[model samples]
Every structure is written in structure tokens, then in C-alpha cells.
Target chain A: MPTCVGVGSPPVMAQPNNYMKPVGSDTRFGAVTRVRGRIDGDGNLVVEGAVEGNISLRGDLQLAVGSEVTADIEAQDVDIEGTLDGDVSASGQVHLGPGSRVRGALRASAIIIDDGARFAGRLECDFDMPAELEERRR
Target chain B: MASTVIGVGITIEGEITTEEDVVVHGTLRGKLETKEHVSVEQGAVVEADVTSNTLMLAGTLTGNVASGERVDLQSSAKLVGNVRTARITIADGAQFKGNVEMDV
Candidate 1:
């Protein structure tokens, strides 16, 4: 190891992958009164209370377990681990984690419905229908 | 870390009541009432009535404000509203247009 100065510099940050969670604040809407309005942002947002409106973001969104939300959402990535009753449009991927209950249409490039997630919505994802199946239908 | 933060690119069009600290680096239109300190960062826009224990504003505020502790308006703050606080400090470079009610 190299010799260091007397008063050393602060610790360097780890690699991006080493940071498991997103950067922005948790933005927790604590479990109390419902939040009503349109939320638009470029940072990652996590909701734990009740919300009724539209959530539009450029980064990511996570709904914690047991939380209730009634809002249409459009984001780069979305993780649902709670109760949602609105349409979700994700540009990247949408993950419905275990124990989540969701209702409404979902459109994303990729989607995951983990085991134990209760979903009642029209799921639309990018699909490549094989030519053989198309020929059979023709 | 504050429990709630309205991120830079976010905008809220309704009321926000929290029992914890709230940082606004985005936009809020309606009302904000908290039992803790609240900071409105520079470049943010708040057109709502604000109530907090301590209020620190460095952005554009266009509503009435009531704080229990104090209200500090930074140099970059542009406020156009009434203020009802126990204590208030207006930085030299700040722009304010409101009635101050220190009696409250």
C-alpha cells in the first residue's frame, strides 16, 4: 500500500453497481392522509402512503408494501410492491413484486409478475410472435 | 436525511401534510404543513401556503407562510407573500413583497 498524507481525503465512492438503491431521497408519503395531485419529476420516487393523481418521472418509481395509490404513472422503470389502482406505462421495465396487488392496464418494454402478486389488468409488453404461429393462424 | 423530498423535476399540485421534515427542490402548488423543518431550495417554486416549525427558503415562494421557530430567506429567495413567524431573517440579496406579522 502507498503511503498516505496526514489528513487523508474522504473515501471514494463505490462502483455504480455497488450502489444497490437509487440516489434520490426516499420521498415517503407516510401512512396517513391521502395525497392528491399530479407528481412529475426526473428523480426516483417512492410512495408509502396514499396518493391519488398522476405520477410522471424520468427515472424510477417504487410503491412500498401495504401502501395505497390511485394514480396513472409513466416512468422509465417501475417497481410495485404495494397496492395500485391505475394504469402504468414504463419505458424500461415494470416489476410487480411479491405481495403486490395491482389493477389497471400496464404497458412496458419488459414486465415481471413475481409469484404471489395479485394483478388484474391488461398487460402489454413487447412480444415477438414466431412465424410458425403466424403461419398456423393464417 | 429528510423523510420527504420533492425532487428537482417533480411538481405537486395539491396539499402536503407531514409529521417530518420536507425538502422541496421541485414545485408545489397548494399547501404545505409540517411539524418539522422545511427547506425550499434554490430554483424551486412554491405557490402554496406553508406551515412549519422552521422554514428555510431559497427559492420562489408566492403564498402566505407561518412558522413556529423562524423563517430564513436566503439571498436567492424571491417571496411574494405574507409572513407570520416568531422570527425572520431576510438576506441582503433576497427579494420579498409581503406583510410581516411578527406578533404571531
Candidate 2:
């Protein structure tokens, strides 16, 4: 009778494959002049001075404490930590931090208001769906 | 990288237009426009029309949204209005009502 080989031996452990990649870090910064003109940029912006005109950026816009802006702001993201005296428009979200003050109207799809923040103005939502508003009128 | 943060104690009331990312931990009222993404944290209150590529709501919003990509309503979010985008997700416990249209 031929002897059969035992099949109870442990199988070889294969190397574990790791396909997860590390997360990338990005750090960008931009500067704007405190004058009476249009301020536009493609990178992140930090306003630590005064702006007396329109501000347009392709990235995030941050208003530092004690900073003041007297114009409309347009950006992908906006974070106000100081004072704004103009209209604010963003394709993204608008954040209002504590102790922050804003005195103008805002238009965005998303918004946040922290405690102790002061804001006074009109608000409009679902701007992208103008047709809905018209339908309601019917 | 190019990120905007609205610190606490800062207040603004006007129209804002941007093409970058934004985060708000404060208070704001007015119109906001952007081409990227916007995030509203808890304790933040906004009354405006928000437009962006993507939007995440974690606060109180009384307005409409026009997101080119998607709109996410977190568990702590309270929104009332119409939302137009390619995709929409409302987390549990999030308050939202109105019309929603997705891109086909």
C-alpha cells in the first residue's frame, strides 16, 4: 500500500501587500495689497491689512484678526476672523469664527457661524437653483 | 495649502466672492460665491446664497446652495433651502428640507 503524504501542514504565509499611499501635504500662501483696486490671486491668501476694493482668489481667503476689508470678496473658501464691510460670495463655504464681525450680505452654498460671532445682513441660499425660486412663484 | 479660515470673534456682513477653499468658525451674513469648496463648522450661522464646487455644512444655514460637485450635510448641520449639485448627502440628525436637484 502506497503511503499518502499528510495534508495538515500549515500553508506558507504570503507577504502582505500594501497599496495604500501616504497622504500628501500642501502649503500655499499669497499676499494682497491694501489699496483701492481689485485683488486677485490663484493661491491661498491671508489679509492682515486693509483692502478697499474687490478681492478675488482661486484658493482660500483668510481675514486675520484686526484686519479690515471694504469690498466684495470672491473665493473658493472664506474664513473671516476680523471685520468685513462688503458683500461676500463664494463657490464653497463661508465660515464665521468667534469674535469675528461682518457687516454685509453673503452668498454661498455653505456657511458656518461660531459662538460670539457678530453678523448683520441679508441671506440668500440655493442660488444655483434659480429656477426653483421661479417655480415657487407659479 | 491655500486655505481660508474665519477665526472666532470675527464678524462680517456683506457680499463675498472667491474661487478658493474656505472654512468658517465664526458668524457671517451676506452673499458668498466660490469655485471650490466651502465648509461651515458648528456654532457658525450663515444666511446667504452659497455656491461652490463642493460644500459641507456643519452649522446653521438659511439659504440655497449651488454645488457643482456635491453637497454634504453633517449631523450637526441645520439647513433650510434648495440645493442644486451633482450629488447630495445628508447625514443622520442633520436638519434639511426643500428641493434637491442632482446633475444627470
Candidate 3:
């Protein structure tokens, strides 16, 4: 899988300062790689391999297609297009993209499952119900 | 290009096994085993036993290394461990404190 987090963007001249680093500095675990431990990062992480450990990141997490992850993940945002067998806790949005196969509970601010995605888990999203639905329930 | 890259600002604590090449530019504290080459880039810090076909270090490594082919310690490398390999090269300015077991 290609480890292109933000392709076709303007090249950064210099680091300038912390928190303004370029997007290409994100971490990538390519195919044929297998990690059996815990990953803690302050940058975005893209997985295109097999991971059997927990992932905790301050940035977004992307599980590329053909990737297999069997660990719980905690990130700001999560986008999965692979096979995941663990719970996901995202402070932002959690998207199960096409070709994703997930089997775990998800807790996020918002959750989106694409049409081609296969999911077998419980969702715990925080969203306000429609006023009509709230009145009908009462 | 390396198949597995531990990029900057990332810290991995555990075991990593790969069939392809690996490049570390961050912090790794565990064991690393690879069938191909392994490179520890500059500014990286590795505290683990590394097993690979070919090992190259340009950073700080504090563990044993067993390489099948060769091991190269660049000038910017600071390694403190034993190295067992068929061939080895330690460039000038490399800070190394370990035993070398070459397979003559």
C-alpha cells in the first residue's frame, strides 16, 4: 500500500516550528510488516500491514486497504479501509470506508460506514436526536 | 524504499517482525527481527535487540545485533552492544562500545 498521507500538496520549506510540521511526517507501517506491541504517537499513523497491539495517537489514524489490525485504537480521527478486530475510540469521526471489515465496538463523536464495508459491532456515537423523534418517543 | 518505516514523533514499544526492509526514524524500545535490511536513521533511538539480514545504523542503538550478511555503523552512529555478522564496517567518528563476532 502506498504511504501517501497528503499527496500533491505544497512542499514545506522548513519545519518552522512544532505543530506546523508537514503532513509527510506521518508514521507508516508498510505491507509485510508485523508489529506486536504498543504504538504511541503524536503524529498521524497509517497502517498498511498487520498489527497485533494497541495504538494510541494524538493525530488521525488510517488503516489502509489490505491492512489487518487486531488491537484497540484511540485517536483523534479514524479511517479504516482494512480488516480490524478491535474496539475503536475516536475523539472525532470514525469512518469505516469501503472494503473495510470491522468486528468491534466503536465509540466516537460520529460514525460512518460505507456501503461496501462490513461491520459487526456496537456503535456508541454521541449525536442529538431529531426533535420530532424525541417528541414521538415521549 | 523501506517497507516498514517508524517515522518521526512515533514511539513503538514491543516487537516488530517483517519480511521486507525497515527504516526507523523515531523511537523503538523492544525487539526487531527482519528478513531483509534494517536501517536506523539519524536522530533515531533504538533500544532493542535487532536481527536482520543486513543492518545499518546511523543513530543510537543500545542492544545486541545479529546480522546474516553485514553490519554497517556509520559515522553518526552511537551503538553500545555486541554485533554478530559475516561482515562489518565501522566508519570513523562512530561511537561504539561492544564486541564484534564476525563469521570470518
Best by DockQ: 3
Q: Which segments of candidate 1 are over 4 A away from where they belong? A: A1-34
Error of 1 at A23 (Å): 5.9
Best TM-score among the predictions, by candidate number: 3
**Residue A50's C-alpha lDDT in candidate 2?**
61
For model 2, the stretches where C-alpha displacement exceeds 4 angstroms are: A1-50, A53-138
DockQ winner, 2 or 3: 3
What TM-score does each of the candidates earn? Answer: 0.84, 0.48, 0.86
DockQ of 1: 0.45
lDDT tens readout by residue for model 2, A23-136: 121112112223345555444456865667777766667787777778898887777888999988887667777868999988776667767778999664453436767799
Model 2: docking quality category: incorrect
Q: What is candidate 3's lDDT per residue for A51-99, written digit by digit as tens?
A: 9999999888889999999999999878888999999999877888778
**A14 in model 1: Cα distance from truth in Å?**
17
**Interface RMSD over true interface Cα atoms for each candidate:** 3.1, 10.4, 1.4
Q: Which candidate gets the maximum lDDT versus the true structure? A: 3
| Cα DockQ of the candidate 3 complex | 0.67
Write down the worst ten-residue block by lDDT for model 2 chain A: A21-30
In angstroms, the error of model 1 at B85 is 1.3
Which CAPRI tier for candidate 1?
acceptable
RMSD of model 2, in Å? Answer: 26.6
